[model samples]
Target: MLNLKNYLCCLLLGVVFASPIFAQVPVQKNTFSGGITVTNNGISLLPTFTLGKPAAIFDFAVKSKRWSFEPQLRFSLEGKPWSFVFWGRYKVIDD
Candidate 1:
């Protein structure tokens, strides 16, 4: 089975790249996203025994014509730890 971190990385990359593919729909200035991740004995890449380790992720994005801000939260669904991430982006001389 794949490790949790690697699996989550791939999932996030997929979400980021897949956004433009849905361009036929109207774009929203604010967006919210969420997902669940699960793994077995591969949470930290070390050799340990764990089963059905699950986590939940929540993210929100605020977008304008030339700037964006995103904040994300991730926590264990099974009473584990949690973390938060924030991102800011701006367009500089878009062509």
Candidate 2:
């Protein structure tokens, strides 16, 4: 009967330690996403490629809780920097 008692105690300890694995976390925390784009002359009314020099653009964003920061950077193909833009945002209303 000693073996049976030891087995029951081990099972109880395992269940107590593993309970937190079943919990759920909020969806709007510690999120990161980004993209790389290659184009010419930025966004234009007419999407013509042959009219200007080629460029590469980088965009990325990081979000945590109710705040987020996004940045956009651009550069030409010949190693010339073009522009930089930063967006800082906060959630005022929740849907």
Identify the candidate with maximal lDDT. Answer: 2
lDDT of 2 by residue, 1-95 (tens): 99999999999988997788776775655989999999865552345523266888789999887789999777788877766778899998854
The clash number for model 2 is 0
Report lDDT per candidate. Answer: 0.63, 0.78
Estimate the overall C-alpha local distance difference test score of candidate 2.
Answer: 0.78
Q: Deviation in angstroms for 58 in model 2?
A: 0.2
Best by TM-score: 2
**Per-residue lDDT over 1-95 for candidate 1, one digit per residue giving the tens place of the 0 to 100 score:** 56998999999999998988766866645544544544442243233422235665566777676778887665677655555667899989753
TM-score of 2: 0.58
Decoy 1 TM-score against native:
0.43
RMSD of 1: 23.9
Off by over 4 Å in 2: 1-28, 44-52
